[model samples]
Target: MISYCVFDAYGTLFDVHSAASKFQRILGNKQESVSALWRQKQLEYTWLRSLMGRYVSFDQVTADALQYSLQVHGFQEDSSKVNLLEAYKKLDCYEDVQSCLNQLRANNVATAILSNGTLPSLKTLVENANVAHLFDQLISVSEVEVYKPHPSAYDLVTRKAQIPKEKVAFISSNCWDAIGAANFGFQVFWLNRNENVPDVLPGKFTTIYNLNQLLDKVVQPS
Candidate 1:
């Protein structure tokens, strides 16, 4: 039986696109999509930095991505504007994420958030969402200075959760993350909210449409 559920934070628990929307609306001019570009660059920089061993906290990486995204997208730099754009760090949860989390918690199953987010951002998110008390643990890859898709990150989770991988069902909206955790021996569940094709990875896997599907899969009988 899966007694523990581990989740990813950004695109998984929180809508990461909120930051870009705030940016675009604030800037008030863009022939281009600032949100998309910022998100793309943030992921790109994360992977590149992780591979290069030039690790910074997720908050720093996000700021750097935003600054460069501004230059590339032709948005003028205003310190206040840049700080507001970093509002992704303060982004709230999706429509009823607390309900899903509460469902798991009420069942006596342990739940955690495993993400690349830094302390300040994750703290604000849990507090603002009023779901901080629901989480048994909040694990961050920032602790290990490596991003997701790296086995060590998942290992950090397994170590921290103190639960064997098989008993913990790992859930990620990112297909690659589900793949990574599976390879690391967790019972991985993919939340394919985007309806996109599953990218190839080491572990063969199963998917669900959203948290409800995941609940059906794990909480319901096998």
Candidate 2:
């Protein structure tokens, strides 16, 4: 049985694109492009840093990625960069997050956030969204000094919950993250919110379009 229902914080629980959307007045028509590039670069930087053994906090990576996105889009104003970074500290949670987490709790399942985000930011995010109490833990990759898709990062859940990987249900909107967790032996669920094609990776996992669908898969029929 799955004892813990662990989620990836950014795209899984919190809306990563919401930060740029908040600055639509300034970003104009490029808001979506900026948001997309920012997310893509953020993940790339983490993977690149991990492979190079040059670990930096997610905050730095976030800022660096945003800076690149802004520059490429001709948004050179310092205030634009500053405002977006601050906004990131309190990203809007997904609509399904609260109900899904509540249902998991009602089922007597433990919930946590396993994120590439730093602990402080993760805490700020959940607290801002008014869902902080719903989670039992807010785990950061900083603890292991590595980012997700890495074995050591996925191992954080098992270590913190004191349960074997087989007893943990790992959920993520990112295909790569679900693959990583599945490869590490957890029951992985890919929250494919966008209906995107799965990545051509080695690890195996079940795909679900939304958080509510997760209930059917993990919650055994009583």
Candidate 3:
């Protein structure tokens, strides 16, 4: 039986697109492209930094990713970049988040967030979304000095909750992150919100279309 439900913050619990969506007036037609590229670069930087043994905080990675996106899109890097980062600090929570979290809490299952986001950023995010009370913990990869897809990053859940990986059901919308948690021995649940194709990563995981489906797939103790 699962004792803890550890969720990934960005893209899973929080809508990363909300950052770009907030500035649609300024971005015009390039809003979606800019948001997609920013996220892609953010994930790439984390993996690259981890492999190179040069760890940086997610804050730095986020800024660099935004800068890269601005450059590639030929957008002005003046006030636009600043505005975008500010918008990202308080990303909107997904529609299904509250009901799912409420269900987990009602079932007496511990819930915590596992994210590449920094502590301050995560705090600002959940608080802004008014879902801060739902989590028993807000874990960041900052604790381990690396980002997700790394074993050490996944190890944070075990350390914080003091539970065996098997008893913790890990949830993430990112395919790579779900694969990482699965490889680390958590009962992995991939919130495939986008209906995208799954990665060929070598780890076992269950895919769900939404967060509400989680309780049905992951059984609670009697």
Best by TM-score: 2
lDDT of 1: 0.80
lDDT score for residue 146 of model 2: 86
Global Cα lDDT for candidate 2: 0.93
Best by lDDT: 2
Candidate 3 per-residue lDDT over residues 111-136, each given as its tens digit: 99999999999999999999999999
- How many Å off is the CA of 109 in candidate 2? 0.6
Taking the tens digit of each residue's C-alpha lDDT, what string does model 1 give over 1-222? 989989988888888776655655566665236666777788888899999999998888877777777788676767735565557767858775788888888777889989888766788888877879989888888889999888888988778877778898898888878898888888888888889899866785778877877777778652
lDDT of the candidates, in the order given: 0.80, 0.93, 0.91
lDDT of 3 at 219: 58
53 Cα displacement, candidate 1 (Å)? 1.0
- What is residue 80's positional error in candidate 3, in angstroms? 0.4
lDDT of 3: 0.91
By TM-score, the candidates rank as 2, 3, 1
Q: Which stretches of candidate 3 lie over 4 Å from their true place?
A: 219-222
lDDT of 1 at 68: 78
Clashing pairs in 3: none
